[model samples]
Target: MTRALYSLCGADERHFFSPHCWKAVMALAHKGLDFEEVPTTYSRIVDIGGGFSKTVPVLDDNGRLISDSFDIALYLEDTYPDRPSLFGGEGGKALSRLVEGYSQMMIHPAIMRIALLDIHSILDEGDKAYFRASRESRLGKPLEDFAAGREAEREAFAAKLEPMRHMLRFQPFIGGESPLFADYIVFGALQWLRIAAGLAMLAPDDPVMAWFERCLDLHESRGRTVTAA
Candidate 1:
């Protein structure tokens, strides 16, 4: 009865980039869990089963099925409370929600804009048609047309993270002292860019860059284990 985490990967099974999936990965890592990685693509989620989920990061803990990264995190915390805590405590748990919202509201879009084309470039041929059709509908244009102006997007991303920059200047992590679910929340976004675009989105001197590196090195190179395929 081993555990398995279904991760969303690109054309190459090695390039697992879904930000939400990264959250689950880090959460499992923080809890000291050993699980097999099950790579998935957009068209393959249904393979998980009906009423369970049609998304990556679906936890197959032995026989149980859990979907949604946040829900999966909570499930892991509840199921393995004895392990190192992912949330830290009730207080950290609550603040992590704020981090999650901030990451989604401010950071996710910027990464997508800068790396959308990069992401598209890595998709397998099987996924390309579906990816293009679905994404283009929301973007109202071809992805190629949408992914222009990396410089402006990078500048915008930097400005959007000013608060995080100021915070990191004093604290080593968003969770203060050590990484917590809060750190995982934002780290997931950074992981997304790293896997999708493989682009250095930050300046060498930025505190956020330092934190990102620390995240990469966390949990015995957990973040770095998967390459952008």
Candidate 2:
């Protein structure tokens, strides 16, 4: 059986914009695994994993379904120890978690709200309704109102990356000499922003942009090949 990854994308199907999906994609590429892409959306997540999962980045490795991007990365590392390592080692595994948490907690929310209106525009009608209701509930306002303040939020988002900026100034990637699951965890956010909003979330001179470009070239520029919404 062929491996298959259920990814979240926009209505265009070509717009694979979800950060979590990118994480899985990068991880699979890192492991040199060929898989079928199952493009999906949030409104349809519950139908994946035989109703056990309600999220994107669900991997059907052969026939076993795995939910959660991080878990999938871990599964890859454990299942394919001989392939290119996603996490360098045990210490790297721990650090990769930190990077993933930072991206999910600190970076993702700000960009999500900023890209809210754009995301809605690219979603299918049903997903659009589900997205608006859930997002507005969390944001406590209409998408337009939230988006009106995005310039400031984007600035704040850039400011929050200062620590990572300092770190990347010395290291080429999060795993020091090379890209790892840690780098992908963070890059997924950049990928998400670029595809969903196509905004310059980082300043022109930021070091993260350089690393992101390198990531795009990985696996035959797989990230770049995915059409943007």
TM-score of each: 0.94, 0.94
Residue pair clashes in candidate 1: 11-124, 15-229
Q: Given candidate 2, what's the lDDT at residue 45?
A: 83
Compose the digit string of candidate 2's lDDT tens values, residues 83-173: 9999889999998878877888998888876887887888889889998898889879988988998888877877777767898879988
Global local distance difference test of model 2: 0.86
**What are the per-residue Cα lDDT tens digits for candidate 1 across 27-71?**
999999899889898888888856468677899898999999999
The lDDT of each candidate is 0.85, 0.86
**RMSD to truth, every model:** 1.6, 1.5
